[model samples]
Target: MRSPQLRDATSPTGCALTATTALARLPALAPCLPEFSDIVPWPRRRGCRADAVVGWGQRPTTARARQWALRHQLPFIALEEGFLRSWGPAAEGYASHSLVVDHSGIYYDASAPSDLESLIEHGRISPEDELRASGLIARLRHSRLSKVNHAPDIPLPASPRPRVLVVDQTRNDASIVGGLADRQRFHQMLDHALTRHPDADILVKVHPEVIAGRRQGHLEHAGRHPRCQLLADDINPWALFDAVQAVHVVTSQLGFEALLAGLPVTCHGLPFYAGWGLTTDHLRCPRRHRRASLPRLFAAAYLHYSRYANPYTGAPSTLEDTLDLLEDQQRHIDAGRGHWRCHGLSRWKQRFVGDFLGPKACVSHHSQGRFEPSAVATSTERQLLWGSQIPAATGVSRMEDGFLRSVGLGIDLVRPLSLVIDRCGIHYDPGRPSELERLIAHGRFSPRELARAARLIQQLRQHKLSKYNPHHEPSRLPELPGNRPRLLVVGQVESDASVRLGAGRIRTNAQLLREVRRTRPDAFIVYRPHPDVMAGVRQGAQVSSDDWDRLVADVDITTLIDRVDEVHTMTSLTGFEALIRERRVVTYGMPFYAGWGLTQDHVPAPDRRGRKISLEQLVVAALIRYPRYVDPCSRQLINVETAVQLLASARQNPPELTLFQRLYRLTRRYLHGPY
Candidate 1:
């Protein structure tokens, strides 16, 4: 044996020249030496003492040489961080020696910066160094350097089941290193691998930095499974390659290493090694070439490698191990739970102050059993609690109290009654309407004044009728014969009054009267008010005769006409009545009748045949197709059937006037505006 001559070197460039000089002295080392850079040609001699020489760096030449060694099955050593930073955590098991070289020359302290300048000054490492040679000593100390001369020649393990290794960097919390989808798939693939290979041992290698406590847990449930062995301690990954059969991963660079080891790899996701004709891919890679070679694959990786720059150091690491390390670092950061503290805070603030004085609180309390209020009482109190055309009555003290309590306000200047009246549709801007109307002859009184005036007008009309005729007219008039079919109109008269009066309801009335008169010269069209409309009337208050007259005048149908032989409608309950009365009915739209093949419908029902259907069935489908009754205050949907049942029960056992007043008071507090 002879001592190799040591040469002084300056730059990393100088180190290469010095290495060439050293190789010149030891002609036996030529074979082990990596293919020289463009500056140095291949040695003329065939036989050399050096079986192989390994180098590590975050550059193209060092990476190319690493790939060449793997392709040639040459034993090589690599620092874990350099390899991870180049290719990712998956490359940990690929090389003969996987060493962790901390920046401070410590074994596992990744926080320290490398002493590359000191090494350069000492001439031990060159100034033009491709990588920090200071860490190399530490790496070699912890690595399988003694076995490099005579690499172990163990055969691949023989197992009936497939061998799989899961490589990931752990963090403080049990989260997957990759994105959500990647994490989920990784778990699924792990489960699949275990199920497919029941007797197989799945090796899970934690990132060296993660094992050293720089990061946290990333494996989650995968790390705890009986089949999985967490490789937290430092061990030569190549030894596992000799023991295991195959490798499984989720886009890990380990797939590439497994390929070099001549081991089969199953990739659950699109890793850089996937679609390179190297691994058994579980996912398709869009950038994959149809026919891939080692050199072509390297070209693709090298070309795309320029896109990334290390966020921490701002340096670029093109080597496979370097990319792996960088990716693992990012994964560690992402998996940490503290990363989401700011995000959670932002969302919490948004929802906290969104609704300070809205219907949501009232409804939420009512739904949660903290409060109970009758539906009718709620509706009536709502009408009065908020200012409306009608003034609050003296006996409605309880209602006022309830409104105040509901709004969390006392009887101050800002009373609930005042707020309601101020905000109500009719009471808004009282001064403008009253002052302007009184000043101008054409102007009308304020809504409150108008309501009072209307009441007086109705009283006078009733007084005159009582003073004269002394008898009220029959609610329904006698039926009459008509040339055209007679039609009846009905439904939510107040809400859809404009539409019904303008369209089908009025049209049916006018057309029936005209056609009947033109054909038989004598026919009748009946207009029936809804039961709910009639029930809305308050006793002792005179009806608006003018409003009634106006409604009749707007429709061309004759008010005197009574009998309805045929009915036309949109979705009015009058159609249902007409159906019960055996009058022929025609539906212009999907007015529920259009589907029941019984009536002459203008619109055809796509789902219904000529089959007769019960009125209850029609009502159920229309009202209960997953119907949700939303609380006007809360805007949250309540159980539809429960609401309906409550309404029916209330109708069956109507509350007394005193009980009603109590309920009105209680409900007024919770009733604000319709949500």
Candidate 2:
């Protein structure tokens, strides 16, 4: 987020823009628009000049861009920030993820046919986009995402009186003038709302810009009405929708959002979404002849009409990418809104855990001896003990390492990009039903979620990404003695929580190896120790030369899993990764994936996890739906797909640790003996 005042047209993503500096001046819009340099004519022109003229909706600079297009006799494109912009208003420096680049007219203006309107009227939407639209809409509602997503999600008035919402817009907003409305329309809209819902109290919603003191709204005086209450705070629109019975608007985008939320909407002004039979529009457009479904309109407006950027990277992106990014942003921000008292995390883990908790969070580390009862000074503060540490009390939550963890070994002090904060229980522990187990049992596998999981699986296979994707490979595994079903015995730190809690009777690598040798005496067994154990930084079970044919050292986990015919694990994540790669997994202990029909289990799964789930379900719950990931490139909260993509990219190798950092890691590992 660079200062908008910077003259260069390049965006924060470091890509050149699609519009001239006149339009790309707002750094926030640069992602949507990708290589414009010369709105400010240089004394001498240099590189390639912009081919087509572009401008944002109705700005003073846009008027100049339009004049330039007219003088040059070229087509002028109108670009407006798309419906799902960012967490907050543009004025607040939150950048835009989506932008509507219209060749005809902008989407907000109903005075003429915009591309969105044309698409709604006569454009064809493919069945795929329609289905995608339904999924996107469902996610939008589920996420409670409105155009600007940074608003505080607070509960609206809980009075028994049915609430009728009145959405107010900035005075003389371009949509107001273009959609055939004026200041008087706000008054009329309010009066109509009062008349139509006499029993309902009016909840007047103010524009974000108005609340910021940067702009004025048409209904600023509406608070004078005894029944009308001004909602001056930047409240989350979807949350507000939940409390309101119906919404009334004069060209405010909240009307469109209300429709998306399945609330009855009355549009007093002819905005682009109005007159499409979706909303009860008092003002209609003859050009909008065809009735529109919510998905159709959303597809036309979001999928077909708008362009998006991989907010983390400057590359062109899809609507789904934006949804994931925004959802993570909200989750991070909302979590940070609370006070956190964290206990039992190693010194190396403190900074990375803070990243998942979000920036605004107030977090204090409480090592065993350092924790004081009164340290939780505020009544509002919450405690999150390390997951798998049986808590003495109930109010605290649990935090653990997520499945798609990081690029380097966690023992090497490589901060993880993903983590799980479970209020229910840690996923690895099947001693009792964890949150992940409950999701496996009760969660429905929608087609959209399953498809996403399927893609993630493909990516994981293509990228060869495992929890800690270190760049090490052992010499080619010794050619199997007879190609007799080869078995891989993956070892873990004996003291690790997963082993202690999840490994039931087979609690140690020594036990796991003995069990495998006894069960399959004929098979050639390859034993690989945990990276930390191999590095001599952690305790490991003793291994004998007679236990296996090959004692592998520093081997890549992915390569090891691929080479094996079957995997033997007592609560190691290697078992889970093996399952994802479609290899046979025999779980001696009760790791999260063992109970499902997908793996051969020596121990019975918790009775609560009775529902038979697919690998796709497991992938969705563990990778897509569960963990929180931060993009290493941007250090911003990101989706699993983006995380995997970043890890897979050849250019995304993590920087070499500074000498001081290396020494620090070495000193800490030796002094503390690994976390």
Candidate 3:
């Protein structure tokens, strides 16, 4: 249990080390670490092998390092501000600003060990801790991200009349991305606010994203009413909330923040905070059918759901730490250096990309193969595409792929809330030996991890969630023949990167189905084509007239999976989806999940996957450990749990689209082509 020394530990598994400034903060543990300095330039860190790495959370540098770590069975410990909000040592899957990282485990992963439940169950709130928690709530509200740093000092109205604030979210954001009513809901809320509080002057606070010109908002052409003023001023949200008579929101977290600030909040849309009795909610959620007090809600959301950090010192933090960091950051902002500043080619690209980033966005592309080599890398503005165009750079493909996603033909930004900038690559690529594969094979599986995974698996199964959701209602599954095993042969785009990479010998969906048929002739075959193929955006393996006689393609995969007893794939994620349903999965080629004992493999398993893992362990590695997530609204890093919840909610609610998205969907044929 003693603090580890660099030389004293040669990683038991010999996983490569990917250290960032996080190691510098832990000088006492430095001598025990290996020489990473020898590896000049960040991209080359991919080749270095160490059991574990220490780095700052969530930047291209650390993200790439994490990608490498995950792919090679290397443990990645990300450091950020602790939940208490000062520079205290913290570790989680990635450094999404809102994530609460416990060295023992992450708060989002319910399976990870936590004390929240015990505290709540036992009513063991220490008077000191309770006081601290309450004080922490006030501090967080005063110094929240939407409030602190770079916000202008806008004077409030001196009128005696009460002011009701209606928080307007960005047109396309995480709240919408995660599954809330779309941009139109904000407009409806505006109309409701006008009707509900005619006596009170209404102020609509525009989201920071809209202010920064990344996307549009509902209030753009509302034509200011005498009682309503569209406040596009980049002022502190907390300040606005403090001055407001009451707060109204569709699904913005500001409503939750306002509640923490001890203000009355009315929620028109269902956010995580709605339906908990704290807010006067229009939406009734079955999940949160119970009532809870402000302190309890605060504990669950802030203490349990978020990890904090001290901006000045790189150490584990608390409210005290945040206070100091906030002061320093505010000072920097006042001095005009607090915002993210970028130079170089990355900045150039950012400008060309139509300013999708927020006001604090800063990017730089420095020469010498690294962006800003000497300057300290911050969590503020992320640096990207450094040396990417150069042939010598290791991450050219990743950079190129990312660029394509951002500006590629036919693919609209609305569809993707978070980007997988880590080594796992894109969501669908099973071809590369992603960090997901590494986690499956070598990640330590705790009982808690397994339990969390089990719950997530259950949720996915119960909800029938799939990657790239088919928008239409699932067709009613045909009755299965008595006593015959149903085998679902999922189809994939033959031209897709996943198939090109993972489908070693059997490259086509038709071939995979044929192989499954050849192996299981007695089993009924249900071939569900890829949704992209169904949409005509891409082509799946062409099932010639000869093969069409035996395969069934009309049933929805979501409903179809329920009737199937087995799933067979070369490398489609459908196999993983089936495994979650407790359906037996037979892999024809090596997928990241293939070697892990979960699925039956046709190809020889890699020697690296000798250790048998449970379903939850696989979920933790693939879902939690592997991907990088971001909040679409706040445009900051978020945890996998948040992403999953958002995905599930969005699936159920399915937000209304903006005019552009609707138009894009309608004219998709003209917009789409091979990139």
Candidate 4:
């Protein structure tokens, strides 16, 4: 019994799929359990009741599952891996992304009608589904995703004229058997490719397990034929798709992937996608009577039948979320230049920094005199300094809190899910250009990118998130005279690096408020202290209540910004947030957002930042492109959208502070500096 070691967190449902408990004999059913609710293990679910028997599709357990279902007079469910599986092979113990639960039959079994086949045949493929399918197909092409998404993209092997790809599968694989294929069929697949494309180069692509040496493939020795070259490297399918003109397969998932890639596919056996008129097939499934379009097939197979789950949080997630998770993992794996050495990292930081930097990171708190001879890493190592900026040095990266940072203040020792590591210069110090600035000036904010930025803006405003997503307590103000423009002065940590570098003549909160008063004496001034200052973890300038009409003890940032007409800031990210909310922002100094034709600049614009930019463009650079985000629970780098989703989730269900967390807050004052 191949009960895979896939248990991490048990399903929140606590029972099996359907009202009748499912006797899930395999751990592979875990991803599917969340959607169907209640999941119970084997013997526990065994009873005379109308329970269902379930097993992974067409593996060694299918016969056992069928017998159990037949003897007990209960139904059976066939589960299989979905289209986008994971970052690594299932045999290698990586978690799955999605699963397909078949009540009638499995997808690979073309002899009978499966839910996917039924959906393809009679399912209503709405215009909306087609539209979404078009987008999904585009995403599939862009992501270059396969059933297994482990390999890195490499340059295509240069072969002769027209390239024909022959996909190889492991011996007696369920799909092959269900497709009515055997070792002879794989040989036939290769032979057909070689004969049909006589003048073309036939690239025989081996299975990932074959490349791992875990299983032998039928075409591993295809190189024996001069015209047929064996693809031994664990090459990414997308990369191979770029070079291959057509694909030949015996029910391998790669054939479906090729069809999705817009490649002409010839299936030697009756795969689920074959007889539906999506691909040319040697054998036909008579049950598949309808001619389905590519989008319709994809819609039925991926969107309708498959269930997606977030590998990190064990929460029910969308296909887009899983794709984001895989993309992030792949990017980080590629981002690894060498080993990472974090200098003077604290225990609190040590726990989470590695979640950003991959597992190759080695953290050494300054107290560890072990490797402290200068603390700078050698050429092959990336040096990381926490919280503060390092002197401009090659390979030494500075880490700081991101703009859409957290639900609570970082000074309070709350875990930050996002951080921006800048190699050029920090975003706040406009004295020199940061990587973010470069992205803003040079990045092609395509329609897709702008749309993402636009979504992020809505998430921020809708969820009311900021650098420190402070509580949304509405503050009452003293009644003011009629029609006076409300000017909001945002305070910043005086000793903070942003104030030290970005602030010019009017540096302090008092100075900013006085300037606002001098500029618009008739305006009703509202001053909101920075959360870090309010928490007493950082220093702030002493200002009497007379400087502003309102102290504004407890107010939501977005709500306050919405009520005000204009915001005055000396490099406060509130200025950026206010800008996101479409409020007129007046900056006393040059923030990264200033000088981009977005804000009212009180100081001369930085010479390097003269380009005019839209609000969407600025967001695409700073939030989407610049900062690296990770889910706190999963400790995996996530896309900004996932980050926003996480922040929104955390806001709705705020976790109660453990005793240690409450204690950690007390010592934050000491650690906020120099740690």
Index of the highest-TM-score prediction: 2
lDDT of 3 by residue, 1-675 (tens): 111221222433343353554444342223222323232223446465454655554445666666766686666655433333311113312222233322332222222233333333343444554565676676666555442234554557677888999887776554453334666777788888889998999888875567678778877554358888778766766678667889998877677778877789988777666666888877665535456667766665455444443121112333343353344334323322223333334333443321233223443434434444334333454334321222222322132222112111223324343333332343334534444556666678756456656766776677666664434555545767658777777777676656665666788877876677677777777677766666555544477543322354555455677787888888877787777778899888776678778888887765656878777887777665444444444343334444555565566666555687656555664655542
What TM-score does candidate 4 reach?
0.84
Instruction: Please give, for residues 1-675, the per-residue lDDT of candidate 1 as tens digits.
Output: 111112111212211121123223322122112232212212421233233333332223345545654565554332222222221122322221122221232211112212321222222222222232223222323332222211222344466655677665444211122211244675677777787678788877665566566665456446678778776655445665667777776655555555545578887765444555767777653434454544333323322111222222222222222323322222222222121101111232223211221212221111112222233243423211222212322211111111111111121111111011111122111212211112222223333223333433333222221100111234534434455544453333333322332234333433433443344333344444433233332111223322211122122122222245666555553454344344576554344344555576644544423445543343332222211232223222222222332233333443333564445444543452111
Report, for every candidate in turn, its global Cα lDDT versus the true structure. 0.35, 0.77, 0.55, 0.75
lDDT of 2: 0.77
Candidate 2 lDDT tens digits, 1-675: 001211223543222223355454444354555554333321212353545666667776667557756776767778787888877665654557777878898877888888888898888887777887887788888989888877788887579898999988887678889999898888999999999989989999886568678899888888899889888887888888999999998888888888889999999999888997888888878788898788898888878787777655555666776776787678767866767888877777786677787656778887856545464544477777777664444556788878888777666677777888887778877766677787788888878678878878888988888988877645654565655888999888888878777777888877788889999998999999888877666767688778887888776788878888999998888898999899999988888888879999999888887778889999988887677787654456777876787777632565566786678667766775646
The C-alpha TM-scores of every prediction are 0.24, 0.85, 0.45, 0.84
lDDT of 1: 0.35
Ranking by TM-score: 2, 4, 3, 1
- Cα lDDT tens digits, model 4, 77-148, are 777778888877756646677888788989988777788888998988787787778787898798777877
In TM-score terms, candidate 2 sits at: 0.85
Report the alpha-carbon TM-score of model 3 versus the true structure: 0.45
Pairs that collide, model 2: 17-34, 17-35, 17-36, 18-34, 18-35, 87-150
**Highest lDDT model number:** 2
Give the distance in Å from residue 642's predicted Cα in candidate 1 to where it truly belongs.
87
Worst 10-residue lDDT window, candidate 3: 399-408
Better candidate number, 1 or 2, judged by TM-score: 2
